[model samples]
Target: MTAPVRTRSSEDLIRAEEPVLAHNYHPLPVVVSRAEGVWVEDVEGRRYLDLLAGYSALNFGHRHPALIAAAHEQLDRLTLTSRAFHNDRLAEFAERLAGLVGLDMVLPMNTGAEAVESGIKVARKWAYDVKGVPADRATIVVAAENFHGRTTTIVGFSTDETARAGFGPFAPGFRIVPYNDLAALEAAVDETTAAVLIEPIQGEAGVIIPDEGYLTGVRELTRRTGCLFVADEIQSGLGRTGRTLAVDHESVVPDVLLLGKALGGGIVPVSAVVANRDVLGVLGPGEHGSTFGGNPLAAAVGTAVVDLLETGEFQRRAAELGAVLRDGLTGLVGKGVVGFRSRGLWAGVDVDPALGTGREVSARLMGEGVLVKDTHGSTIRLAPPLTITEDELLNALATLGRVLERSV
Candidate 1:
């Protein structure tokens, strides 16, 4: 018989990781060992129901069989040929992804930030080349509290001090406007405006959903002013908010769609910028590229991811379970809750200050065998996988509710 494998417990692994890993993130003190569907077993063999979904990167759930099989098959066949040489899977993947998002073209990148940057480049080039903006004068208007990426240019326009402090002498030609305020967006864009980049729902800002019809107003404003309307759906898109794209909630379509995170189906890192011929075709050659931008391995995995989103089953599940989770927790609002937010399977809950902070609830919930995360100070955001059974969701919520009641 084979010897049983021995793995370090969660605490032991977390201790080792603290030294080597950069302090960029303060993750919940749980080391995941194995996961399937909606459950994660820590190194200690304690199974806590996953509620953050790797910040929505695992929206389809951990180690999805289809995506995993695709990755494995591609790993055995071919992985990378680089942009220097064309690969078989990239073209097909791009075509299908663009079709899924209803765009004409797709630019492959690895991270959400890269896709945002690519969109920025595409917008600026279009503004300069086609819209008659003066050279180096184009501006992209973004909202306050926007979390596009960590790159210098992205951090430059950020309103959050923590995200921007010690990060500047920032880039110029970017303007900030109050989120959910259409008039503010209108006032900020001008003749030099390259694009109006916005997230329909600000996921990182505690699942902040904008006022109704704000997205439609943005669409009209951008269209009337002849500016590119870019939607950063990296976090809120791909069925996290009960829609293929959250913009669908307002029936608004943007000129450019920035997609990432769950686009790889919880198996690999894949992102793409979906646009039409005029916008994406602006890149002739020697302009932008990534070493692994559209590697065959990612392409194979991406095709599976895109196809999975098309089924619409996961989105429906999210909507239903989300209703259950939010309804069950809403009663705590006046009693011990400081704030409550929900859409689909995503939620950002705030505990009463007297009961304790989000950290307290998360820690206590871990003891109860449920794992969620805190963000934006006291807000605890839950984004459970759509594949989780209702029984599992209810069980986790019972634990979650007990923790909330005690803290509230």
Candidate 2:
């Protein structure tokens, strides 16, 4: 039997989705049909340099050969065991991931938000069982304008009105303090504080990097206050920021590390909470578990990801290419760019309002065969895949410069 051929354009697909799919996201009009490395082809066969890189989920680029091969091999074997019975792949995955991050244990999950939620639970449990904090008085200190995840509990303490509006009545036991302010953080922590949760580099808040020694201060303060330090590296870790972990830049180690995004190698959804036994050990049998967590398929892909990072090739690429990116963006400072904050190849560029809003600039760039995403009013993030070649990256930057000039 022959299958019926379909002839729907990108506009048709977009229109078709509007009525049936949820309107939670306002994505760009481009409908990608295929991708490889740092380039994606839309439904109509137009190619664009992917500067956004799936918001760091594609840190290794789309359909990396090694990652795809691992996935294919795993699919041929076992796919899922539902955490009911032990799988052969889980142990090595856990061990390699833990060793790569210098942690003692790994609690695998499917998404970044789930890893965050699990970290919260682990911190609270450790507070009661180990730290001797009172049952109901455990509090976690978080930074203002931080982007951890979008769960109901995670959003409960968010300072952003858009994220929290009408999503309450909310959970308590979270204290918000100004980010990068050691004094404010110290003032907020007390006997009831169970942990201080923070993003080593605030990704959603426009890649906001803290002042020097801020993470170090966080470690010292958490240690002195008898509380755990949890670094939400879901967006900043696993070679996204030219290091195995962003905290490595400061030589600081948090008690708990939340990892996601690149963990699944851009092929599947894989996230994990890495911590020492003292912190994650607080969980007992039946306390918390995920049916698909630590499944064999995720394990295989995650192990492959760890293998890639172990060679330090991606980390080196991000570091070396980061210099080029910094220079390119710096040259645009007096052009249409106002300023930017960058570490490694990841950057948040502030477009001059006189030119246009970030969204407008992004749309124009898309027309110029480049792809980027806007965050705030006049800010766009750039995090190209580490696998992008020097020529490709420079070409994207040149396109960005041209787009800005045209906008003006």
Best by TM-score: 2
Q: List the residue pairs that clash in candidate 1.
A: none
lDDT of 2 by residue, 194-217 (tens): 999999999988999999999999
Clashes of 1: 0
For all predicted structures, in order, the TM-scores are: 0.96, 0.98
Clashing pairs in 2: none
Give candidate 1 regions above 4 Å deviation.
1-4
Task: State the weakest 10-residue window (summed lDDT) of model 2.
Answer: 1-10
**What C-alpha lDDT, on a 0 to 100 scale, does residue 313 get in candidate 1?**
89
Q: What value of lDDT does candidate 2 attain over all alpha carbons?
A: 0.93
lDDT of 1 by residue, 279-356 (tens): 888888899999989989989999998888889888888888888888866866776676788888888888777777
